[model samples]
Structure formats: C-alpha cells, structure tokens
Target: MIPALFDRRLIARRRRRAVAAAVPGSDFLVEHVAADLADRLAAVTRRFGTAAAIGGPTDALARTVTASGRAERVIRADVFAAGPAGDHPVDVVIDDERLPFADGSLDLAVSGLALQWVDDLPGALVQIRRALRPDGLFVATFVGGDSLTELRAALLAAESERKGGASPRVAPFVDVRDLGGLMQRAGFALPVTDVDRVTLRYATPFHLMRDLQAMGASNPLRERARGLTPPSLLARAAEIYAETAADPDGRVRASLTLVSLSGWVPHESQQKPLKPGSARTRLADALGAVEHKGE
Candidate 1:
C-alpha cells in the first residue's frame, strides 16, 4: 500500500472539533460549492432516483439534491462518527476511502469541499464510479493546487528566512488539469473539470490562521512538524504576508480554488464520438471551397 500522506486520525479529530465549534467556519465555501453542484445537477435532463454525499462538513449538498426532487433519497457519510444533526442528516460514518455502497446502486454522487484530504483519491474515485449505475452522474468539488497560495508563500519565505528551511505547512492539492484524466482512469465517461476561484480578504494573517483552525483545515500532513511552531516564526510569517499579500486597504488576501469535476458512467443510451473519416458531408462542399491533394 502507498504510505499515508495525511494523518487520518488527526483529520477526523480536527473535523469533529470544527463540527462542535460555535462559529460558522468555512461553511460559506462549502455551501457555495454545494449550491453550484446542485445547479449543475438541476440542469441535467435526467433525474437521479438515489444519491449520496461523501465526507463533507455540512449536508448542504445532500439537502440540495433532495430538494431538487430529482432524487428520491440522499445520504451523507463522513469519517467522523457523529456531527451536529441538521435537516439533512448523515446516515453513515465510514472512511471515504472505503465507501460502503454496493456496485451500481446509486444514481448520483456528490461531494463538497472534500476528497482532497483522502490519501488515495484515485481509489476513492474508482469506488464512487463503481457505486453508480450505468449513466449515473457524479459531481464533486475540492480544494485545488492554487488554494492558499498566499499563505503558502508567506510560510515558506518566513521559515526559510528564520529557520534556514521550511516544513510542510499546507497540504498538497490536486491540479484541475489532472482531475479529468483521473476520472477517466477511474472509468468515468465524458469527464470534465473546471475551477472556481474564491478570494476573501482578512485583516491579518493571524485571522486567516484562526479561520483555518476553526474550519479544521490546519496542517494535518503526516510529515508536518511535530513540535509547536515557534511564535517568532508565526510572527515573521504574518509580517511577510502583510508586506507581500496585503491590499491597499491593509487587508491580506486569501484564495481558495475549488476544482469541480463531473462525469457519468457509460451506457448504451449516452452519445458516443464518431469514428475518424466518417463524415456524412464533405467540408469542401459545405464551405464552397476546392480541396487540393498533395502533389
């Protein structure tokens, strides 16, 4: 097996903490992505009778899917054993890497602001694809490579300047360009990927860090530094961030790039690409142009 890149236990603990937090942290991003996913699903001509959302902070996606009336039922699953019960309740708590659904059982699958933390993304995608029936749809959004660019740069610069080196503070995210290929590799047909860049302004880098902690999005990389980050390092990083990333208003900018991926299971009813040299009409004839052959 591939060595784990994220500490799953730590991730689960942080997630539980985020769930219990009094403040609403990072739900805005999750809600935005969930609404976008729901809109995409609404646009589809086909209706899904069953759907599931895997490992998201809120049940927004599941509720949207259910409210669309396209799906008869929707379920939410996460690694954490329990969370705040809401209108859209979680039905299961299983590791996303090991989905419990049976093959060909679902008509749709959606996730919001999740899956990026999974150690084996490709494997998880394959499991999702297998769970979907033929012609079933899959849509998801996760943090992309461009997420937290300012913070990453500031951290690196600060650590290099003070400690003569840097440790992994930000988790590596998937690139949008690579997602389509991953979907195809996982047996998804007509795979598509796009990015939604959301930028927010913060008063200071400390505020940004606080939000990350509240959202349970703090560094959970297996190789992350074991000891407490020196207060001086954080102070220097905040200074660097303010100097380099702050706007004229004196607020620092942070960006989250949500990479949306969509695909469907292949079925006989779905459209297929035409074979080469199978055109019904000649392009020259249609365009009223002469065709010249190679001499």
Candidate 2:
C-alpha cells in the first residue's frame, strides 16, 4: 500500500462539521458541478441500469441522475454519514478509497467536486474501475492544478514577508494533462479529459476562506503547518489579493478549474488504434502531391 498523503480522518471530521453547519442554499458550487456531471452522463448514448455516486455533501448527482432517468438506481457513497432526507438520500457511507461493492457490478460511476482530497487517487481510480462492469462508464470532476492560483500567490507572499518561510497552505491538485495517463494506468479504454475554469468574485479573502471551510476544502495535507496563521499575515495576504487580483468593481477573483474525466471499461467492441505501417495508400497520394526522392 502507498503511504497516505492526506489525513483522511481529518477530512471526514471537517466534512461532517461542514454538513452539520451548512445553511440552506449554501452549496451552490457543489450542486452546480454535480448537476453538470449528471447532464453529461445523460448525454451518453448508453443507458446505465445500476450507477453509483461516489461523493458529495448530499447525493446531488444521484438525484439528478435519478430524475433524468439515466440510471435506474444510484447508490450514494461518502465518508460522512447522511444527515437528513434531502432531494437524494445517501444509500451508503464509506471512505472514498474503500468502495463496498462487488466487482463488475455497476454500470456507471460518477463523482463531483470530491476525490481531490483522497490520499491515493490512483488507487481509488483502480478500485472504481474494478467495480465497473464491462464497458461501464466512469465520469468524475475535481479541482485541478490551476485552482485558487491568486489566493495561493497571496498566501505565499504574506507568509514569506511575515514569517520568513512558508509551509503547505493548500493541498496540491492533480493536473488535467495527467488525467488521461491515470485513466490508462487504471486500465480504462478511450479515456477523455477536459477542463472548465470558473472564476468567482469575492468581496474579500476572508469570504473565500469561509467558502472553502464551508465546503470542507480546507487544506488536509499531512505535513501542513499546525500553528494558527498569524492575523498580521492574513491581513497582509488579503491586502495583496485585493491589490493584484481585484477587478474594476473591487471584487477579488478566485479561480476554480474543474477537470472532468471519463473513461469506459475495456470491451472487445471498442475502437482500437490502427497498427503502424498498415496503411495501403501513402499520404502523398491522398493529398495529390508527388513524393520527393532523397539523393
């Protein structure tokens, strides 16, 4: 097993706290992303009989899928237990890495705005692939490497000026370019990956911080600094953010890059790459151009 990069226990605790204290309509980002994933899933040609939604504050994706009639049933799984009966009730609560389903049982698996915090992302992807049946689809979205660049820059500058050094303040995110490789490593066929960048304007850095906390997205790196961030440093960071990232309207911009990844389990019917040196016609012939001979 790989060493844990994140403190999963801490993640679960923070997520539970966020759920308990969450106000109605406070999860607009999560809801929007989940609904988008469901809409994409609905557009696929294949109809899934049994699907699973891996993580969310609530079963938002599951509810969307159920309503669209894309999946006959969707089992919701998360590290935190279900709080109350929402639009979509969770059917199971389990760690993101530990999926409690039989191999090759599910027709589709989807997750949104989660999996970025998992300790072993590659391992988790493998588990999800194993749970999927032949030609089963996997669609997921998570924060990408470019997310929160402005805030990260501000924090680093503040910490450097105030403390003369800095510790890990934000969790490292996966790169979109690497997603296709990860899918191939996990034995998925015809992997596809794309990115959607969403920039949100905030009144101040404090508001951005609060939103992150409410989403349970505060840094969970195992090697993160344990001491409280100095107020002076935070104020300086806020000032820096306003000066550098603020718009004409005076609202600071914070970027969130949502990377969507999708792949299907290997099936004999799926398209395969043609072998090299197998083409009967030359490119020159197709383009109606004469081939040049080298002396």
Candidate 3:
C-alpha cells in the first residue's frame, strides 16, 4: 500500500482516538481486532521471511515477527509514512489498500483488520491478486457477521419500545459465506474463507462504545443519522442494552467476527477454450448405418 495512505490513516486514527478517547465505545473492539490482525500478519512475515512489513504504530502485528526471535533479514515500511515506494528496506509495506508495488511482484501479502474499512473490497482484492506472481498467496482478515450484535439488538429494541420503530442504523458487517465467493470471482485460486467470533462482555454499553471509537471505527458511512440523538433516547437505549443484553452472569456480550480469507494466483489453470473444430467424423455416415440396420 502507498505510504501516503498509511501516514494519513495513522494520523486520522490518532485524531479519532483523541476525539473519542473520553467516550469509551465500540472503538475498543476495533482496536482489539486491529491488534489481532497485525499479529496475524506478523506471523506470516516471520514464517515466509517476506521482504517487508507494514502497519500502524502499535503494530504488534509486525512486532509479532520480531517478537518471535526468528531474526530474519527483513525490512519494514509504514506505507503511510513511506516517502517513496520500495525506498524502505522492508519488503512488505502495510498501509491501507492502495498498494505501491507493481503487478505480480510480491512474494507474499497480508493485511489485518483494515480491509473492512475499504469501500471497494472486490477491487482491492483483485488488485492484491494482481500484485502476486503465479501461485503467490495473499491472506487477510476483516470484520464481518454478527459483530456488535448486542449493541445493535439493544438499540433496536429500545427504539421499538420507545418510538415504535428503529433509530439511526448502527454498523453493519459482511457475512462470511458471501466473502468466500468474492475471492473466486476475483480470479483467485483455491480461495478459502472462514469466520471467528470473539465475544467479550462489557460492564456497560458506554464502555463498549468507548472502545469502538478508540479504534477509529466511527460511522464513516455516508448514510449515517443526520440529527443528534436525544438524551432520553440514548438513556433508554443504554437501559435496554443493560437490561436485555446481559449474559447469564449479567455482563453484556459483544462479538467481533473476524473473517479470514486466503487465495492463490492461478499458476497453471486452463484459461482458453479447446482448439476449435478438431473432430472430423461425419454425422451423415452414422445416420445411414443406423437406418440400414433398422431396415
């Protein structure tokens, strides 16, 4: 990914964390998932000895590589802070989607926790596929299905109990089953996709929401609510979440589903139709023989 994008994103995430640092919310969940994603990428780095790594400041993902004590000769790139592509000694550069490398150039590619933030997931996947040489592989994980289930349920229930309808929409997630197909459609071979739902209990909805903001996962969607939420509405929403979303022991449960996918660039797959009109047998001769036998 382009270093400029990474730099901008880190700056933006920092700003977002600063803005909502006081209000503990869903950002916390995003942070946890992001960290997990980073760690996953770092593992790939360590194992494959990929030339470079890319990520945010608290990049335990890349640090996972260093922490493993493998001590390979690898380079790291901030992608966001990178002034020129490949200028950094690191072979992998993890920024947002805008990959800086040329097509079919990378040996291994990974992205953690950030693919969910992209508007054009398919396009990005295609680009990633193109960046790899034949048989080169890409692995990534993103937020999907049933995430923030409790928050969504509580808010919807509260809205129903209060206004007899829905409030502003909360975040939405992609289902895992659908994303798997997307890999095949993008021309990736042996595509694999699966989901992991990490459930956590929160003391309060307020705390849940606080964590959300810290991860720079605020509602960036254009169709978000226009007007401010009324105090009564928010109070009722929190009440409903606390009252209804409690687990057996009463900690409200929230889940973050990480959908992981892997795909390989087709190495030797058939891409063309069979040579045209190779058969020379005549249909008329066969019909004549059948007719004679009937006689």
By TM-score, the best candidate is 1
Query: What TM-score does candidate 1 reach?
Result: 0.95
Q: Which ten residues in a row have the lowest lDDT in candidate 2?
A: 81-90
CA-RMSD of model 2: 2.1
TM-score ranking of the models: 1, 2, 3
lDDT of 2 by residue, 1-295 (tens): 7767788889988887788787566688888787787678668876888999888766677777787778888788888775564533467878787888889999999988888988788888999999999989999988887899999899999998888988878888898888899999999999999888899988999999998888788888898888887798889999999999999999999998999999999999899999999999999999999999899
- The residue-level lDDT of candidate 3 at 28 comes to 50
lDDT by residue (167-266, candidate 3, tens digit) is: 4456566678788788988888878787777887888887776666565555544454567767787788788888877877767877778888888778
What's model 3's TM-score? 0.67
Off by over 4 Å in 3: 1-57, 66-97, 159-168, 226-228, 268-295
Candidate 3 displacement at residue 57 in angstroms: 7.6
Candidate 1 regions with alpha-carbon error over 4 angstroms = 83-89
TM-scores for all predictions: 0.95, 0.92, 0.67
Better of 2 and 3 by lDDT: 2
Q: Between the candidate structures 1 and 2, which one is better when assessed by lDDT?
A: 1
Clashes of 1: 0
**lDDT, each prediction:** 0.87, 0.86, 0.61
Cα lDDT of candidate 3 equals 0.61
Top candidate, metric lDDT: 1
